[model samples]
Target: MVSVPTHLVSADTEWSPLRSVIVGHAADSCFPTAPPHMIKATMPEEHFASFRPKNRFPASLLDRADAEVRQFVQILRDHGVLVYRPKAIDWFAEGGYTAAMPRDGLITVGNTVIEACFAWECRHREIELGFSEILADLEKDPVVRVVRAPKVERPDALYEGIRGFGQKDAVNGEVNGTHTVHSHEWAINNARPAFDAADFLRFGKTIVGQLSNVTNQKGVDYLRSAVPEGYSVELLDVTDEHAMHIDATILPLRQRLLIYNPERVSKRALQKLDLFKDWELHAYPYQPAPRENPPRYMTSGWLLMNVFSLDEKKVVVEAGDVEFAEYIRKLGMEPIPCPFQHVNSIGGSFHCTTVDLVRQGT
Candidate 1:
């Protein structure tokens, strides 16, 4: 099979026609045993203990998630897309979790593959899963510049503040379930620069990044400094306390069309940014309980916003989201419904499971 050339790996915008992508593996997926407080901050209060260190994801759930991923891959193949899977690792023996979400580790910008600096200890080795695919692209094209995240030592004092509560109270509440200590060494702290791929919303020359538990100030600074000249990164100041990734909050399906979780964004912040005002924004009306016993531990029902656009006129929505599909159709886009409720257990949907390597337009 001819791999996508490294030079062609540039994705200028999300609405462009997609030709190549890296789909995640659901097999052997384990919940982070030592997930950072950043990860915990995104979960619901009642489900906070589920991701504690030493706790592994259920095997039965992993199998179901894998089954859904297989179907998603087939759908992409049917659409004439070239899909690459991660190099399956022995997540159990290796310690930590699996490389099921490539979107969290790799960020491809204008033919360059940036290895994201992870805030969670378990995610440090995730880039290795796609090494073979990246190597092939590099061999085919010299324009590819692989930017590696700089390493940083842990700070003597790590600080994190939760809404309405001091860092001490917040940390104690999460760890002891008592809402006590207000400040302390953060369970997970990015001393230097670190960011997940999902932190960005790329739109050609303009990109929007949100400050969240997973993405720190340094991470945002690093991205702003790294992009090519003429391109700019904007910060989306969403006030939601649990906001972890930008995909579930703001998603641009095609040119002049976007979808967002109304609850996840601050209206005042949205108004100040002229970049998003012109676009026709539609609020996804998601009423949880999309399925009985859906995985609420890892992600919220807003995962419905995590759809992937195949082109300007076609998008891959979760099969369970019939209402969302209809909404997409109303917006004049074709919705390719594929079963993904099972895969949501692993913490993302189509956009979260795959990372676009190449898009048709700039």
Candidate 2:
């Protein structure tokens, strides 16, 4: 009964000629009362007060982000790309939901589409918003693999300290032998099978990912095994102290070019990674420092690195981030500027809000 596409359903790399994509909806996207570990990880210390359960995202900000996302969709449609939007849901009334940031929940590998296991209870239902759209894609592309992420273990409190260092974490119940705990407490713990779609970046034959508060070692392992034969997954040594998604920290412009935020890449890992030495690693230009009390959003300013690619030579950037665009030009790519500050205030930009569903060729 499902309609399936005869050819592959997805593009292989970030800069490939994009043909189809899923654009997230800002409308009805609800902010979570109980944020996941990764959400807490990336937040600035001062903004902690805003994430409290009772807080609601300013309606004005949501409207701006929604307008910006619509503009982005128009730009893609103008370029002849097939764009799909997620069905809207009442995230606030139906419990915690994140309407935007689709890149955090869904991803496509080759022709296969995978619905990732979100790391927090707050976002567990996010995939529901896009279920109809993904099902349609599956009907059209039967060969595409659809892997549902494994169920995760949710504890009352995820402890982050050594077993003996602090009184056994009474919150999560059982005290496991680990150095960290993943929770609202922001502690480190044994890596488990918890991952967010944003933690991955795809290349033709390989994928590069990072372990952060949102993604655990086991989750990375699961991903490594899920891909089709001939494809590989590599874990990057990026600092995950306030671990979250990697799109803002490292971006591959093309096979040979990479853009990174120096603050996020670990100094130790930077020295040991020989692959980086061979590629043209352009340290992204400076961004204005965060205000003394930056408006506490769910994410950090590194969202500036969240750029989207039309192809190896064309990419979408924020209209206000002139420095990022200039750097894109320096890399020999054309930067298409769009207004995204409002949507960004909600947590992500073009790359975060959009997921590529099809690229032109292998």
Candidate 3:
């Protein structure tokens, strides 16, 4: 079972478990397929090198995203929440853009964080503590069931078939002129060798429609072992042949209320999410935009929308993402904005930064 912390505990206070998410940026070393050589070869070295590793915000930074990430996270923590952050080279590499300081970890619940699955998940990258310790008392409360993922082998096949194009070698940087593809480290690749192909048979049979593109065989494997028995995870085959990121499509915002960009997510995943009638779904009408290759929409994954502070009728989003202010207004949520904008290029928005630990009780 998970743990919950509350310094000023109240009997009536209930917990939704999936609370607010902190907004911050970290290097995704193995996952995003960022090998310096491969990245440089594919795009203009100048464009890729524009942002050096630093903790500064917008004007000083290449994209003015770091400030957006850090401040947003800090605000969430201030609101009594738990935040989980990645600590490592990839999360802060040249391509990465997180404030090296420790205060920028994450906000999971209101203020309490369960540190049980910390280091193993590489969330802190081994780096610990960054936010104001003055809030430690409130931050220590934990009310969550931590589900740790078990290790698996042959996780590569997922990225292999999902990420790279036809006939491209994933193990090494293979190229055709300017385009290059890199292998992923997150994929599970272990098996009896002989039964390796058969290992996925059970999951294969469950495939009712298109499978999610961002989800690899490894992600599915995670559900097989860790997901709670009553709560199951179904990989929706939601892929918009035109979009780049998948997680952005089937977003899990605040548990019940979610904004799904069906265009970006596969139709199957959309159906799966719809199956849960208990929750209300807000479908986004995102008309396909011309593919902007040069600056790929600054990788707005989820961090931008992670931590949403609700003040009765309004919800606050990280100011770094300009849309935060506007988006809240659209949701009938008063947009409480901030001034952070130092970490957008890393491929995350306000929502992408932190993994939600807990929410207010439903």
Candidate 4:
């Protein structure tokens, strides 16, 4: 059902410096894409009254899924892991993403956090990009801080995802995930998009279930149900074209490693295509067709690879050969590949598989 690398058997995960990670609901519909079947589970009689996740998830696979992820987060924390929570951008609803306490791994340029809009999801609460300040407070170190684009504009119809025409459709039509670019396009530091969902899911975002009307608001509800109370939600406002997909250009990785469709971003984004700051990036080339069973990039996101592990030089990526290898190399970092053979078609990779709760150290 999935393709894994032959050499991964000997690959060591021990040396990994996994720190913060991003988690998502397993077997659930991808963000912005609703799983229609989930609607059949029956909402709690009181859900309409209180609209509470606990009531909705009184006991079900969805509840179980949330527990597994939370437990996973707790287990890692117990092991001295400094988990930094990534806000779940409920693209399908109003509160776009739920903000996690800021820690390491967040990025900023010009005194403005690249994740500023992420805080916009909540009405009363606000989540700012505190990663850079946090990192600065400790080491007083400075990495590249430059605002390349102001905001990403949705891709022209020419580049939006076109059916059947192959990448030519994707390219001329937003060539990669650029289809989701917004009215503006900008990147502080023009950091590589690899660490973002778009890069990881260049091939396609694996959407399970159906569009069950589980909108961003519901997504926010789901987060409040799981994370500790001190937290709030922040969701990105998105429209058609890009829909609710996570924009990869802004993901903040403590490590500079990146994954993305070089063609989908702006020339500024493209300018940094080969630049991997101290990080050994991995590139997973995507195949435009099912006709090409052995797609170039199999480790697409929205699946098992949606996590951010704070490991050492030995980062575990659930990708095959080709772009995966190139991706790590692009980051100026080394790769500790996973067994995923054809992850792209299925949609995901190591990052997609695990989620991040960032901290200074793990």
In order, candidate lDDTs are 0.71, 0.70, 0.36, 0.29
lDDT, residue 56, candidate 4: 23
Looking at model 3, which ten-residue stretch has the lowest summed lDDT? 193-202
The digit string of per-residue lDDT tens for model 4 on 1-362 reads: 12221211111121234343333332221211111111112221112222212122112433444444455556555555544443343322432212222211122211222221121112112222213333333232243222221232321222123222122222223222211223332111112111121211110111111111112232234322332233323333222222223432222233344443333333343234333334433333554222244332212232322333445444444333535445455655455444443332223333433423222222
Native-structure RMSD, model 3: 9.4
Model 4: residue 344 alpha-carbon error in angstroms: 15
TM-score of each: 0.87, 0.85, 0.53, 0.34
Give all candidate RMSDs, comma-separated.
3.9, 4.9, 9.4, 15.9
lDDT of 2 at 12: 70
TM-score of 4: 0.34
lDDT of 3: 0.36
lDDT (Cα, tens digit) per residue for candidate 2, span 298-361: 6666777788988888888988778778877977889999988878766788998888878776
Candidate whose TM-score is highest:
1
Give the higher-TM-score candidate: 3 or 4.
Answer: 3
Residue 125 miss distance in model 2 (angstroms)? 1.2
